[model samples]
Target: MKYVLFVYGDEKPWADAGAAEREAVYAQWGAYESLLTEHGARRGGNELAASATATTIRKQDGQVLITDGPFAETVEQISGYMVVEAADQAQAVEFAKAQPGEVFLRAVHDYGLDHLAPAEAPPGVRYTLLVYGPGGQETTPEQAAASAQEHYAYIELLLARGAFLDTVALQGLDTAALVRKPGVEVLITHGPFAETVEHLGGYYEIVAKDLDEAIELAKALPEPVVEVRPVVEYSG
Candidate 1:
């Protein structure tokens, strides 16, 4: 099974930290990455730019409304995510427990779209579209099927435009687990993280010419809200 570890934390502290502090944090992350790589569990992942750099898009009254900022205001925002292939939920949980800050782990729902490769750099800049919607809502079989078809069609459009890099659909929150490190020990809690009106459902990573083009492409997502952020690039 594949799991996504969503790393969340308040950006303020990092922004206020001195150069030495920032380097220390980066070193910690490097060590974490090494651990995952050594275990052969790392599949793919990326660090996202700050939430303030996010561009949100939603369809309101048949018009696509674009705005600057995240979909919802929250104390801690998502900083990055790591995708890992694990034997089962238990193993995935163990991986999360090793991570820093608050980590939300969700199993990935395979849609057989894993064969798609991300576009090359010359094609455009990469952006991740964070899909959010009302969680724990029950839907009939017919409704579920309709939603799947809509998503398939939308994905086809992205593929034709060469904008589709990778996409992931997560299982419901009931199956999610949250890992938090407050002190020397890591606390693990089964999720339904909070009683929020919106919850992150999944995400789409795509390459676009620029922000405007990315927003135009994101408008086709069949979701209530899509928060688009540029993927950070690091030189080795």
Candidate 2:
């Protein structure tokens, strides 16, 4: 099981500390992460920016309302998350309780509890691939001619095996968002995700045998870091 630790605390103490102290604290955190990786227990973690910059949104009476602030007002507010892969909840709890910082716990909620159904038809899953450094070079006549035949053949192999759900190479981040309110039809503003990362070059979605199988398939895809999570089928 993979568990998430949500950190909550006031930002004042750290801010009150001097720059050297803050750097030292970061160093300590880095050292702790190193220890976890060395012991083969760490998976991933991130230090999020402060909540003052957050924008909260919600749907109110058919209106998509937006607010500028953290989700709530409180002395202790969630700031970041750390994920750890463990054998079970008990083991995960034991590991988290021993962390140097105060942390709250939540299982990486597998929304697919009902998905334990019999594997009749192959599952319909989705994967997102992010590519970068397109090299900006236009295709030459010879290069284009050579790639056409080989690329078509390679694509045929995937289609023949039912492995290609769908694929698209994106232009840039400007195209990531989809318009939620449709303020402007041609200038629609929206995205599949919030915040931003290095590059969301592309994405893919396919069904596999199981979690492990899904990962195995995802790892083979061409993404620097492919996030793998199962889709929870809607039961009606």
Candidate 3:
């Protein structure tokens, strides 16, 4: 099976730390990655940028609205995440506890991303796989292309199997913000925080049989961390 480890922490320390101190902290993460590699449990992971530069977008009443900032404001911000292949929830929890901050572990559910489209989803709760990590801007163009190719192929396979619903690769923080009350003459702008760390770089909507099946799909992807959350069916 596979699991997504959402690593959260206060960004003040790292953001305020000296260059050397920050480097040391990064080194710690390197060590952790090495450990995962040694155990053959490291599927993928990443260190996101600060959350100061984010763009949020939304559409309503046939109009699209754009703004700046994350989807929510919180004290314990997401610092990073890791995608790991484990035996079960217990094993996944063990890996999370070893991380350097508070972590959240949620089982992936089997639901397709079709609900996001105009067509109705089949009779069942679907799942949305949120891919969080460093954006392509963090790397050289060549590297980003190569990494994207790997991910694209993985996605293609899922699509072929009728499991993929949608896939979107987002722009970097420089172009991030929030769009509130779209489709109106006037728009409100709530930009991203001044200090940005992590952004939702991309995402995938897929259908799986259950948590285990979802993990299997995640384990095959090349993303650093893939978050699987249940999509609630609204009757209203």
Best by lDDT: 1
Candidate of highest TM-score = 1
Query: 34, model 2: CA deviation in Å?
Result: 1.6
Task: List residue ranges in candidate 3 displaced over 4 A.
Answer: 109-236
> What's the CA RMSD of model 1 in angstroms?
1.6
A best-first ranking of the candidates according to their TM-score comes to 1, 3, 2
Question: Count of backbone clashes for each model?
Answer: 0, 12, 25
Against the true structure, candidate 1 reaches a TM-score of: 0.94
Task: For each candidate, give its TM-score against the true structure.
Answer: 0.94, 0.46, 0.48
Q: State each model's CA lDDT, in order.
A: 0.88, 0.47, 0.57
Model 3, residue 6: distance off in Å is 1.2
Q: Order the candidate numbers by lDDT, best to worst.
A: 1, 3, 2
- Model 1, residue 168: distance off in Å is 0.1
Kindly report which residue stretches of model 1 are placed more than 4 angstroms away from their true locations once superposed: 119-122
Report the C-alpha displacement of residue 223, candidate 2, in angstroms. Answer: 28
Better of 1 and 2 by lDDT: 1
Evaluate residue 37 in candidate 2 and report its C-alpha lDDT on the 0 to 100 scale. 76
